[model samples]
Target chain A: MVPISYYLILAAVLFSIGVLSFLLKRNVVTVFMSIELMLNAVNLTFVAFAHRWQAVSPQAVSGQIFVFFVMVVAAAEAAVGLAIIISIFRTRQTLNIDQINLMKN
Target chain B: MQLALFIIFAALAVAGALNFLLQRHPINSALSLVVVMLSLAVLYWSLGAEFLAAAQVIVYSGAVMVLFVFVVMLLNAGEEERTTGSRAAYFAGIPGAAAVFCLLSFVFLSESKTLGSSNLGGYLNDGTVNIVEISKILFTRLLLPFEVTSILILVAILGAVVLARKEPDPKVVTSSTDAAGVIVIKEKV
Candidate 1:
């Protein structure tokens, strides 16, 4: 059996990658994709803990429930976020975050 | 067998992430993100969170990703030249990612031997947990965060609708210049 640490480590790595992508990417869509990556990383950690302590106790279900909430939030976020992106694209003809500066020095 | 599964998932996740990051097209990036979500769903199932695995697929891959794809289609956003941020940003991001990996590796190496040392009693069979039970805890114990999430989603929905809703202005496009123009606009509509 693979150890729980392996899964945790994988989660952490993915999360970091997501953060890097989010930070560096200027396109709004790519930034959104990075957010998806971060969410997936959290899901990975939840499942890892869920499996690590699968004793049919509260701890077992906690991770799953958290993942459930994460899904719900992701759904709502995508709905609204994508709509906003579309509107922005319609007006500006671009999704470049850097060029969309409303307030800058 | 578990190792093989882990390797497969890890590869899929990495490939998907790269696809998402490297693609210039928003539609392609959204598609890649879907692939990533599916791979994570599989990983969730492997970790015995069957309900979570299903939710990951249905909610994220099915619903959320589809929304992303739909919006991309509606907006008709074309590919743009990639933004290579400042050299300082490049330097900072790479080291930041590397440092995170190093930290995670340190934790993994330190805890690897200790993981299977302690048995977690027994594995959950039948592979299902009571949603009602979990909901009770969530509502009672996690009420604040739960309400906050709801509010966030609500705000997001309203914001999207307000932003996307357009009052069509006749002046945005001028009167048809030629019979050809009318035909083309008709076709587009």
Candidate 2:
């Protein structure tokens, strides 16, 4: 048996790494990927918690269901977000976040 | 055995994440993310989420990552140039993320006694198929949300198509004087 706390800790570490990449990365696509990573970490946490609760009540699979919804939403987000990124790239001609500052002016 | 598998996959996931962060090119980062997703799918299986594990591989590693790679190739996204990033991000963001991780770990550790331990395939031992159990809930109690997600995906597809369509090129017009002294204009699409 693996301690559920260990899984939670791993999820936290992955999430922190996601945040670090989101903040430090210059490219828009990399930042978007880090967001996906963060979502994945959260999904792992949900699955871990669901497994912990499954030992008590077998019917308690809502966490997994929530993870399912999250995956769906993530898929939708990735589609729309990548399209927006494509449009931004078409107009800006560069993928660097720093250089795509049209709204600042 | 469960503990060993958990540790190995957890280490793989973390290493893939770090590689994603350290990679300069979008394609490398995208591939690293695939590694992370695949390992996460394995973890999901270990946790007894067999359906989610399959979905994680198919949807996340398959569909989402393919989309990312396609966009990267379409745009010809090159290696990220090393720039002196904002001082605030370096000084605050890194420590802030570290602090968040520390806090979350502390909380989970303090509650470890209640969290309990999970056996590998613990939910599968009762002879109920994992997919059937999930579908029972998903189709009955969760049907509304499931249907709603279909609509959401539809909207997302429409939005992506509209947003990604190329703009029409503006027509160029040239005015010339003929021998008759009348102005004639020719327009090129």
Candidate 3:
């Protein structure tokens, strides 16, 4: 059996990678992707804990339920997020996050 | 057996990430992310999170990724010009990545020591876990978050619609049907 710790560690690593990517990448779309990666990492950890504890004593399905909800939010986020990205491109002719300096000042 | 499957899924996820990082085209990166999501689904399945695995595939691979791809296509995001930051900033990422790895290792080691093996009650009853029991506990305990999630989805939809709406031309909307139609204005090349 693969230990639950393994999954948790993997999730943490993936989340960190996502964070790093989000920081390093200058493209708006890539940053959006990095955010998705971070969310998925959280879902992985949630499911890992749920699987581990659910077998022993049936306390609650908190983790699994959380994952479900996160997925729902992610879907809605993607829908609106991409639409906005397209609109931004239409207006600015650029998809670079760095070029979005108007919001900074 | 299970460990092998876990390793395979992990490899797939990592590979997808690597590909996404290196790929030039935005659309390709979006597609690779879909692969990563599928591998996560498999991982969830192996962990006995059947419902979660299914939802992962359906919600992520099916819905979110498609939207991502659509945006990539619609924006026509090409290779971006790489701006070299200062040498200090470039080198800083190395230590940052290492620090993150160490933190993850520490958490995993500590958690493994504290978590004890619990008896697999009804999950092992019929060689498959009961989905009903899972839902019951979810609805009962995590009901508030569940409702909030729905609201969040609604907000995302509304935000996307609002953001994507073009600056309406007063002359363009002559009718109700035209009002609903989105005018795709071509950026002056």
Most DockQ-accurate candidate:
2
State each model's CA lDDT, in order. Answer: 0.74, 0.94, 0.76
- lDDT winner, 1 or 3: 3
DockQ of each: 0.50, 0.83, 0.55
TM-score of 2: 0.93
lDDT tens per residue, model 3, A35-85: 999899889988888877677755446677778777887788778778878
The count of backbone overlaps in candidate 3 is 1
**Per-candidate fnat, comma-separated:** 0.63, 0.83, 0.56
TM-score of 1: 0.80
Candidate 1, which segments miss by more than 4 Å at Cα? A55-59, B117-122, B126-152, B167-189
RMSDs, each prediction?
7.9, 3.1, 7.4
- What are the per-residue Cα lDDT tens digits for candidate 3 across B86-164? 3554578757876887888797878786653322221445554656766786678667877888788778778887888
Q: Which ten residues in a row have the lowest lDDT in candidate 1 chain B?
A: B117-126
CAPRI classification of candidate 3: medium
